[model samples]
Target: MLEALGLSTVNESVYRAMLTHPALDVAGLAAHLDLDPAQVHAALDVLADLALVRLDDTDGTARAVRPQTGLAALLAKVEADIAVRQQQIEAVRAAIADIAVTHEQHEVVLRLEGIDAVRDRLAELARTATTECLSFSPGGAQPADTLHAEAPLNAAALDRGVRIRNVYQDSFRNDPATLAHARRMATLGSESRTVPTLPMRLIIVDRSIALTPIDPREPRLGALELRSPGLVAGLLALFDQVWQQGSPFGEVPGARAGELTPQERALLQLFADGHTDESAARQLGISARSVQRLMNALTERLQASSRFQAGVEASRRGWI
Candidate 1:
C-alpha cells in the first residue's frame, strides 16, 4: 500500500517497520525486517529523502531511527483534495444544466402559421429524423402542401434508411392522392395504414421529439412541439391505439370499380366543387360536425385534408 505513494520496495518496508517500532537502532531494525544491515541503512536513507522517516540520536552513540510527524498532515491533505474534487464535479453538473436550458431556447420552438409554415415544418421533420418518422393524421387533416410536396423528402428519408409509418382514415380508400401517396411510400418501403376517423394529428420524429396541432379546424394556426419523453410517449400511445384498428394502405374490400360508396362520391364532388365545411354541410343537410367527421374519415381514407385536395387526389386516381 505504501508503494502506491511512490515509495521503493525497500523504502516502503523500512517505513512500515519504522511506524511499528517508532525508535530503533539500525541493528534492531535490520533484525526485525530480516534484511541486511547495509540494505536497512540504504532503505532508511531513501525514506528520509521522502520525509517519511528520520534519524534519531537520543542515545550518545547515535543509534536511533524515527518516523516524521508530518505523515498525519499528508493524510489530512489527501482528504481535503478529495472533498475539493467532489465540489468541482458538482459545479460542473450545475453548469451543464444551465447550458441545457439555454440550448432549448436557442433551438427556437414556436408555432408556424399558414400552408408555407406547415410545408416547411414537415420537410424539416423528414430531414431531421434518424431512425423513423411516425405520423397519425386523423381524417386527412394534413394540408395540401404536405400531400403533394413531401414526396421528395420522403424519398430522401427512405434512401437514408429512415422508416416512415403513416396512419390515415378509412375514407382514404377512395382518395386518388392517398392511393398515389401510398404507392410512392410503398415503393420506398415506407408503411401506410387507414383507420376510422381519429380526433387528432400527431407527428413524431426519431422517438425523441413530437409535434401536435391544438385545433383540427386550423391545424397550422396553433401547434406544440414536445421534447419531454413522457409526453411524446403518451402521444405515441394514443397513435398506436388508433393505428391498431387501421387497415393496410391500398387494401380495398370489394372486387370492382363501382365498389365505392355514395358518401365517398358526394364528399369527393363537394370537395372538387370548392365547398368549405360550412357550405358543404349546408348543402348536404347535415351538421358541420357531421361534415367535419366525414372530412376526417375522408382524409384518413384519402389521406387528405380539405375537399379541394381530395378532388385533386380523386382526379389523379381516375375516381371522378
Candidate 2:
C-alpha cells in the first residue's frame, strides 16, 4: 500500500509489523508475517537504511521511527531537488528572450529550413571559424549517418587549428560507437565532455555565429542561425556553465565507491522532484523500463532491498 513511497510490499509489511508488534523480536516478526528469517533480516536492512528503523545501541533490538519524523526528512530533500529543473528552465527562457529581441531587429537571425541547409551553413562556418568552435550535442547517441558526415568537417576544423569543443549527454558513455568516436576526436585535438542534460542543441563558431534548433524538443523541424553578439554571448555562457559541470570525455565518472554517475544522480533528483518512471525516462532520454532496470541495479549495488533504501543511503552518502 505504501509502495509509491519507494517501499516494496515486504518492506511495508515489515514496517507495519514492527510498529504494531513493538515488543516482537526478529524471529517473532518473521513468524507473525509468515516470512522466513532471511526475508525479515533483509527487510530490516532496508528499513535501517531508510531511517525508518534503528537498532537500539544497547539492547540491539530494532525499533521503528515515527513516520512523521522519518518521512519528513525525505520530503525536505525532495523539496531541495526542485532547483535543478528550475535552473535549466530559467536558462532556456533567458536564451529565448534574447533571441526574440534580436530576431525582431532583422538581419541578426536567419531561418534554416532543412538538415542539408544546416550542414551547408555549418561547412561554411567551419571553414571560416578562426578561433574556436563550440557545440552542445543532445540526444543519447549520434546517428551513424550524421557522425559520418560530421567527421570530415571536424577533421578539417582541427587541421586548421580551430579548436573543437563539444558537450554531449552523459548517456553517450553507454554507447560504444559514440565513445569510440569521442576517443578518435580527442586524439585529433577535440575537447569534449559530458553533462547530464543540455538546454538546447547548439553550435557556436568563433563565439560569433550560433545555430540553435527552433524547438529543442523537436530539432528535426529546423533551426535558427543567430549572429547577434548578445544572443551568442548568452548561449556561450550557458555552454561554459554546463561545461564546468561536465566530466571530460574518456574519463570514467562516478566510478568510485559510494558515488553515482552524473546521469544517475540526475535521475534520482528528478525522481525526488516527484517524477514517475515514465516522466523520469522522458527527462533522462531512456525508456521507462530502463529506468526501472537502473533503479534495480542501484538497489543491489547499495546492498539495499528496495529503491527507498537505496535512495536514502545515496542521500546519506551525499550522492544526490
Candidate 3:
C-alpha cells in the first residue's frame, strides 16, 4: 500500500513501524526493527518532515516519536494528492486523443512549449511513419538523451523497410555520439548525410506529411506540421532541390557545387578581383541593393555565412 502511494521500500518499513509503535526513541525503534540506530533516526526525520510522525518529549530523557494525531487524515491527504496527479495525466492523454481524432478535419499543428513535448511528438512521428523519412536537423538543438528515446522508433521503422534519409549540419560529423548514431542508422539501411549547414529543422514522411520550424530559435512556438498532400509535395520539392545540390552521406561538404547561379558567378568574379560590395555594385552596373541581394542569395544558395567563404566555394567549383 505504501509502495502504491509512491513510498520507497525503506520509507514503507519505517512508516509501518511508526504506526505499530508509539513514543519510542530512534535507538529503541531501531532495536525493534533490527535496523541501525542512525538509519532509524534518518527515517524518522524524513517521516516527521512528511507529517506522518511527531516527536514526543519523554520527561526530558529521550525524544520519542509517535504517529501524527490524525494518522487517518494524513493518509487521506496522500490519497488526494495521488488522485489529483492521476487526473492531470488523464487530461493530457485526453488532449492528445482529441488532437488525433480531429486530424481528419485539419493538419493538427501543435504549439507545444516544452522540450519534452517536442521530443515526444517527434518520437511519435518516427514511430508512426510508414514509408520514407527525411530529416533536416541543424546543430545546437536536440538533447543528448533524445537519441535514446527515439532509437526504438527508428529501429522499428527500419525493420519495416522504411527509407530514412537524415541530413545534419557539417558540425555534427565530428561528434562521436552523432557519428555512432549515423553508423547505427546506416547499419539499419538508413542513409545519413552532413551538409555545410541547414537553415532550420525539417521532417517529411512518405511525401504525405511534413514538419518544419517557422523560427528555429523558438522551435516550440514556430513549428508547422503539414498533412496536406499539396503542402507536403511543396516541402518535398524544396528538400529534393537542396539534396540534389548537397554533398553525399559521410562526405565533407568542402567547396562543392553541383549547380551555380548567374548571380553567384558575378559575385565570385567581383569578390576575387578585390572589389568591395560598393565596387561590385558599380562594376555590375547595378545598385548596392542588387549587390546585397546577390550576397544574400548566395548565402541561402550555398548555405554560407560570408562572402570570402562563398568565393572560396565558387572557385573550388570552377565558377570563378
Tens-digit lDDT track for model 2 on 1-320?
66545678998899989889899987899999999987887787667656788766688567998878876775665566577678879988997786677778767998898788888888888888899999998867787877887888899989999899999988777777887888999999999998776777999999998999877777767789988888789998998999999998878666665677787888888766657789887676667898889888888988875555576668778888
Which residue segments of model 2 deviate by more than 4 Å?
1-101
Runs with alpha carbons beyond 4 Å of true place in candidate 1 = 1-109, 140-143, 253-320
Across residues 178-263, which tens digit of lDDT does each residue of candidate 1 receive? 66777878988989877545557778888877777746666767566667667678888887886776667767523255334544
Minimum summed lDDT over a 10-residue window in model 1 is located at 59-68
TM-score of each: 0.46, 0.68, 0.47
Candidate 3 Cα deviation (angstroms), residue 208: 1.4
Candidate 1 has a TM-score of 0.46
lDDT over C-alpha atoms for residue 252 of model 2? 65
Give the Cα lDDT of each candidate. Answer: 0.66, 0.81, 0.65
For candidate 2, give the lDDT of residue 139. Answer: 64
Looking at candidate 2, the ten consecutive residues that score lowest on lDDT are 72-81
Better of 1 and 2 by lDDT: 2
Could you give me the TM-score of model 2 versus the true structure?
Answer: 0.68
**Cα RMSD, each candidate:** 31.3, 5.9, 25.2
The numbered model that scores best in TM-score is 2
Question: Could you tell me which residue pairs clash in candidate 2?
Answer: none
